[model samples]
Target: MRVELDEERRAQLPPTWQRAFDWAEESLGGRVVAWEAQPRWRPACFFELEREGEILPLYWRGARGEWHRNTRPLEREMHVIEVFERNGISVPTRFGLCEDPPGLILSRIPGRFSLDTATDEAHRRKVLDEYLAQLARIHSIPIEEFEAIGYRRPESPEQSCLGETRGFERSYRATKTRPDPMIEFQLGWCHRNVPKDRPELSFVVCDAGQFMFDDEGLTGLLDFELAYIGDYAADLAALRTRDLTEPIGQLGDAMRRYSELSGREIDFGVIDYHTIRFALINPLSVAGMVTDPLPQANYVQYLAWYVCYGRVGLELMAASTAVELDPPSLPEERPSRRSVAHVHLTELLDPAQAGDDGERAYQLDRMQRTAVYLDRADRYGEALESDDLDDVATLLGRRPSTWQEADAALEELVLSSSPERDPEFIRYFHRRLSREEALLYPVLREQQGIAVPPLE
Candidate 1:
């Protein structure tokens, strides 16, 4: 019999009952006394509790359901930790996986997760050097164990670099609710310029520069979702993404140290190739959020991040291809049109008023994000829309009143056209994204860039 809870039945429900918390209870073999969501970009559910006599700090290793990222298989991540743990890397000791809620319960590694708290400037520099050493160590791990565990192996050197793209390509096809011209442009460009010359593959964590530390030093290496056997240079190149939030070290200095540690000559061209690949593929992670939002998901916050960093990625991608960047091409700002409700809502956003430290942190996070959008509006407003419509007219030979129409028209043009298959596609998409990025510069975080000369 189908029994739906009415008002009377709902009143009878347990006060402490939550589906996620219930899973945690069963996983821990005790009732969860307290829990809090971890503040991170990725989906994670973290908590601390007592089981019998001992307090256990645990993280639910994977999301509940329906994530669109092209990540390596989750089961592989569990095995990955085991592989590294044997070699004496500092990873969380796994307790066990919950069969129902579907995540690994990891015994938390103790210490501060951020490196910013390290007051000693000398240790900070030493820590960066240690990061490169760790990367070398990870890459040095023999691939035979990974192979034994059925980690996907590439057929050739080209496949080694390009194979990682398959996950994102598959995901974009399945999760994209609308046409994305820029993402299509990147996909097409990648097809045209897959790297042919590459050295031997190694066990590379494609997303490098992620780990936690305490006063003692590198305590816990974290987030290996993109691990695979690929060009080791791609791992070195991926640190550029890390530099956006928390920098590891200077790229050239790290390269030199890496070469010393591994006794392999550094190839800037190969590094640049992987860098361009990073630039092209990164936007797909948040493309769905920007185009069409899912209910209760913070699409607005992610959209701000995408717009800010997506521009930098485009600039670097274009620069890698030796395309000339145009000067700042900004749109005109419109008159103040802040509504009554908008002003009152902005006034009410107070981080201090939040009930707890976590809530305060989250409140501050959204405040900064809200500032980015407000900055975007202050700088460009509806004039940006006009620019997009003009671009659409040029590309499709028809004017579009809204970006949804423009985006669809461009995707139609891109899908049918040979621009994607030809090398000239680089120049074409470069022109589009670079200009768009320029418009968004006002809202972006101030760049503390360490310059590296173009590849030979």
Candidate 2:
């Protein structure tokens, strides 16, 4: 196959790439017959190089700083992958690297993408199970051997959890373009709930979409840049985040299969928590990415899917007996000046106090400020409630003597605040509601009410 390189893509290539390409051709004894830059979001280009009668896929990234092809860390990782492949582990066939600028040449794996090309539920499950099996094998490798192969683990559990929490916080903080108390609260929750005693760690493929498949149904992992010796749950979490459509039952089945095959009893509880954490991490990370210079439409779609899936994961985690994680206690819930300031305006607009005009006006102003705070916290329900209250206050400010108007206002609030619709919002609206009550009863009642015919 002749690789075609267009002028535009060639122009996009870094100035040092020509030298690197020449080096690769000479070093590998390949004829540079044809090459085209593959479309990708990353700062790398893919090319097809024909060498000694066989065509091969090649990739190269431009060096940003002092790091070059001969750099210790990058070369060390490449060598680790090479070693893994030599040991009969399935990996991409590495031809070699061009030392000048440090580009990699490897034989592309031939298989369809597991995500895009799996045709049926059975096939998808098989692929996912296979992926998990591979992960198990990787994780089962000795920690010392993994470290010898250049995998580095976090120094401490607190450091590892804190690092994960920090990444989530940084992403969310950056994307929303403002500080969020809810996000902070969630981060604190995750940190506090970090599991203890599940210390099994090994090298894991960390990049979001590292697993790739070709037309032939074989899967190969890619992007070992973020590979590290870490908690096994992190990898499972990444897989959950990547494969959002895969049911928790299927994941459990995969764990069973992996354990049976690898002779290691996997902790389903740890994976379950990490999977939910991964889902929660997605919205923040992708949101941050979209704010970058090259905002990708595909990434936006990925973020949307992840957010929806993450919400589902959140509900499932809440329902699951396995997910025992809980957030840290708030600094203060008492009715301090700050807590009072945080009250929603709608709550202040009680119909019982409609006769007290002076108090109503004062409360409305306070509610407006509270709305601002709730909005910052991503507490949309509370924010909207405040807005509704403000609307009622406006109505009352027009005519203070109208008792019917006040009653109508209260009814509107009640109808709008009903748990029948937007159960997720209702939970946030009324934090006292249990998860079971918030999710199940309202849905069941709504369905039941529809099924039973009303008296004419």
Candidate 3:
């Protein structure tokens, strides 16, 4: 049966074709075809083509540049796809880049997305686990051999971590809605706590929604456009962001499986942090697409999950009270476990301070410690005897001289601490405060006039 394109959809096509029927007929190798707009994807038109005996399906991504674009990154992605294909991986086989508007052509795989249809609980669990294992296999591919093939390593873990934190700060400031204090506090805490490091890197299939499975089994992972040599945990974080219905236990199970299969210890902490960051960042990308009333319902549900999961992850990190684990001990000295003590101190003081909440907490903690040292030096026996002097100093340092000063400082910090204005500096400030708290805080707090309150 020949497929007839709707009038509205046909109108969107270029005038090279006289009619909707002709457009489908011409596009499908001169054969009669049945076509319809893919459900839930209004921009792309899908056609099922049939000739004498062969049948094929082609998806035409509409010429909307915003949703789909031919860019350097995309071109790089296609190159990686070719590499994976050579390795006997079953991804969408590229027919060729479309000549008309230059979109990539791919051999359509046969299978419905697990997300698109309901499955039994057992099947869902199995499918989820299988997909994660598949992800592990994809990540296991060595990128060093492919380096000459235009494979670029993503920014180091430290750089990417700082970038994400900075990105969130920028987005939060730009949002029309009043920023959430809790989120701001958490970001500050993370900034003050998480360390900068470059660990092992791996290839990631940036978007996992393109993963396809057939009744036979997992068919293939798709969409390598975001593929890069980066922290594998970051890719896993992206996967966890999409999980709405399952409990953390299930996600943990998948992570455990990946670890077992890959022989690489999965850093659950890093995964958790990056997952929260993913949740925090995704809303901006999907906001415009979520405007329609019908779609907004689904988007709201997704958004709610991301927000909740993000908060949960943050709380877990906060409660854990240690940001980075101890690195392997050297022959001379054992690796030190970095404490969130400064982060805790910062949280305690931020409600009152004028600077970056994370920085303020760090500085306050440093000043208090210094004040303790200074008090000891000055022979203030009473202050030195007090175990709570650090707390007092932090609190005192945060209090405004007047209500007006507090308000002004808060406004300035909120305005100036955004990523766009000072991404590198903001990241540097946070990184410095996180790793070198004892060094950075004393000077910072002295500048703020952080003083020890008199003991009653």
| Candidate achieving the largest TM-score | 1
lDDT of 1 by residue, 402-433 (tens): 87887787777776787433334344454555
Report the poorest 10 consecutive residues by lDDT, candidate 1.
63-72
For candidate 2, what's the RMSD?
Answer: 16.9
- TM-score quality measure for candidate 3: 0.55
Clash list (residue pairs), candidate 2: 3-35, 111-213, 111-214, 111-215, 112-213, 112-214, 112-215, 113-213
**CA lDDT of each candidate?**
0.64, 0.49, 0.48
Off by over 4 Å in 3: 1-32, 39-42, 51-53, 61-73, 99-102, 115-122, 160-198, 245-249, 284-411, 415-456
Please, what is the TM-score per model? 0.81, 0.57, 0.55
- lDDT of predicted model 2: 0.49
Residue-by-residue lDDT tens digits, candidate 2, 1-456: 123555564455456656767687677776554454433233345666776678776655433222234445456557767756754556777667656665555666556454545666666666666666666777666667667765556777655533354555664665565332223333444555667665556665654335555434445766565566666667755654554432223445655676687676667666666665555565455555434423222332333333354444445445443333332122211233344444555455443564433333434433343344343333233333343344345433543234345445434543344333233322232232122122222122112111111111
Q: List where candidate 2 sits over 4 angstroms from the true fold.
A: 1-23, 26-29, 59-77, 95-105, 119-129, 155-177, 207-219, 245-249, 283-313, 320-456
| Per-residue alpha-carbon lDDT of candidate 3 for residues 198-239, written as tens digits (9 for 90 to 100) | 467777665443566665556766667556566677776666
